[model samples]
Target: MSLKRRSFLKGAAGGGAALATAAVVSAPAQARPNKVMPPQAVGLLYDSTLCVGCKACVAGCKEANDLPVDVSTPDALWDTPLDIGPKTFNVIKVYAEGTADTKDQEKNGFAFIKKSCMHCVDPSCVSVCPVTAMTKHPQTGIVEYNADACIGCRYCVASCPFGVPQSEFDTPTPKIMKCEMCKHRQAEGKIPMCAEVCPTGATIFGPIPALTEEINRRKAMKAGEANVFERRVIGSGDTHERPAAKYLDHVYGEKEVAGTQFRHMSAVSFTKLGYPELREQSYSSQSEGIQHSLYQGMIAPVVVLGGLVWAAKRASHIEDEHPEE
Candidate 1:
């Protein structure tokens, strides 16, 4: 009887060891490469130098989305949300130094940055969602969330590098919320509300390729050079003239995490504007690559299960041969 029990224990341990080995063997040698941008992808370009911190984009987003006002002030007289939240899809943040007298200077000046969904090409939220709650449009490359499919798991909230997805914790029926780039407006032959209402052409909406060209054009311009910036849509001819500020050489979201549809140009360093520095490869690509490699065709799990079943059968035969003395 003692020998039979030992045999069963050994069989179980051997099964577990086999399972671990199979899993390790199934794993790929390297993580998957980052996904490429969609062919017809559209996106936003935010020039921090042109932004006036007026919050017009915020108001326009709320109105276009039919979102309620988010009041953070004690008086509740104005909708002055400090950052992006459930009801606030977009907001402008200011970085200040010393007297904050200058606009784009980092030493004794202040600069404004727009905060919203980055709409990553390889979205971590889309990869982490257990249900198909978060999805990216293949054609437009817009990241969208479906409340009906959401299981309230908050995986998206945890996975987003930009902290864009916000959960409605205060409500009884909570839902995750984020920007969707005004898809409805686009269907109606209109542009994103924020871009349409931007008086300074700070935030412009257009195709990703065109926006990249525009970014390059901006980068080549000399500091204080007067330029005509397009507004609303890239080719709308609705233009505004302003002397360009000394822009940083780096363009945020161009290659970070493989790329994002929303790009930003700033005179002040992006790190100071609360943007996280990230590598070219996306988190989703690495994790999903390993997961898919292990589970492809259910090969690894089936192998492990088969080993366990064979061990269990051997243990049962041993028990039968030596009945419970």
Candidate 2:
């Protein structure tokens, strides 16, 4: 029955009421819908069947990005990176089964997969970043990182579904590194270095719509049929003739996490190629929706803070009124 106790009870009730009101106000809320692809979205189409295990794309990526050579070999004579790292933005990973005699076969075959940023339409990195260092270009949909704006939180590294973002932990001033799809080259009317140097047309860069069309074209082809695959960019005169491998029914990144700019088609199952199966809805969309519902207009937090302040002031007044109490 003390004044302090009564005041505490009132404050608690008021805070609860405020929270209830906020929840009621937000009752109609739904998780934010996944973002759509940008109007002029550009991306890459990677065909594992066409890749010849050549590391030309890897070298091109490093050279285009001005990254340091990752020399893992003891001899250090060549730039040999086993995986994508701070110094290496692109890498070719191989998956082999049994004797690996046949390429792109699940049994007794080996397959190559290119690893890099997926450049999601609704990127979790851009969503989770406290700072605006991680951004998705409105027109190009290229997920870009700004070192100056980065506080080295590594939120992007953790939020990425594709595990593309890498943090440079060894350096004093570390940076989050990932492929930006060679936006700098695109600005100059050039394609990404990886696509430019790919001899087999495994990786080609172009607008999303065009890429989709090409993907459809490839998907419609009969297995082992001789075909002409365009190299570098879509509609480019550069091309080569080759036989098509049997492609899987699925096209990766089409709906995973509400779609990504980079599309992958392979004869080997994506799961076997180290791709995680993701939902159509992006994690960011759900997280952001809950956040918005709870903290909409910042009303809930302000009300809670005010209730605490009122309780504290009341306690101070009660102490002054009854010195022994």
Candidate 3:
């Protein structure tokens, strides 16, 4: 390194160290430990094996949420987005292979996948929202967005690993939109709009604990076994008759991305259905630790200013003694 570069690095080393120390020292000592959520957080349990890809959930979601129609083709007036967008909150993506004959089979088969907010237990969108516009409900565990509080920063959209949040680029006063488990409907003891209208009982909603148990029970069953799955919210007083397909012995959201409130059970692999493999260690935990350690409350900053002020004064005194014409 050059001489000036070396000198600057040496000076910054002390400043950085001091800043880190101050931040950590100032952090609240009474920080509470994270609470474990019961199986009761209302969420979606999409069984890919049962889905027929009718797109009823998508249409219902747009109508319930009041989102605009997505016209992919210039000639087409009907809304049919190939993927999720600002106007389309929920979508059903298709995974076709070979001849695409069988349903929920990895080879020479076709499977339909639901795409929307996973509603993560440790949601990065909620953690990174600068204005707290995106927040997680303490009791319900539902992640909701308030457009009035939003500054149109779109940080929630960028931070989400599942790409659930989308910004309204077509409007000047745009807002972020994603799944909220239909908080408004929940207040009336009604289930989410998507689940209420789902014909297949594929997208069932329930508390995390109850849903997990149901998922496990299904996983233990053999293919073609008779099972009655509930549509809309589990125990919302609705049931459907169906046979279980041979699952891949895995649950998609059980452990992915630090576990999501919205769990998924699929006969086909999650990768085939467009779900990205994500690390268990939440990005928020790492980011918060780094920021807290580096700059807590401007304590180190004041010390650095003091040092700079002293250096400038000493240099001025040296210049007076030298008296350069």
Best by lDDT: 1
Off by over 4 Å in 2: 1-29, 307-325
Put down candidate 1 lDDT per residue, 1-325, tens digits, no spaces.
Answer: 3555678687888799878877776756367889889989999999999999888999999999999989998899988889998989999999999999999989999999999999999999999999989999999999999999999999999999999999998898999989999999999989899999999989999999999999999999899889998888899998878888899999999999999999999999999999999999999999998788878888898889888988777877767777864
**Candidate lDDT (C-alpha), each:** 0.92, 0.90, 0.79
TM, every model:
0.90, 0.88, 0.85
Off by over 4 Å in 3: 1-35, 38-40, 304-325
Better of 1 and 2 by lDDT: 1
How should the candidates be ordered by TM-score, best one leading? 1, 2, 3
Candidate 3's residue-wise lDDT over 1-325, tens digit each?
Answer: 1234544555566556655555555545332223345345667798888788899999999988888788889888888898888888889889999999998888999999988888887778888999999988887888899999999889998899888899988878887877777788889888888788888788888878778888988888888988887777777667877788988777988877668888778888888888888777676766666666445576655766666655545545545565642
Worst 10-residue lDDT window, candidate 2 = 21-30
lDDT of 2 by residue, 141-205 (tens): 99999999999999998988888899998899999999999989989989999999999899999
Error (Å) of candidate 2 at residue 32 is 1.3
- Collision count of model 2: 0
After superposing candidate 1 on the true structure, give the runs of residues whose Cα lies further than 4 Å from its correct spot: 1-12, 27-29, 309-325
lDDT against true structure, model 1:
0.92
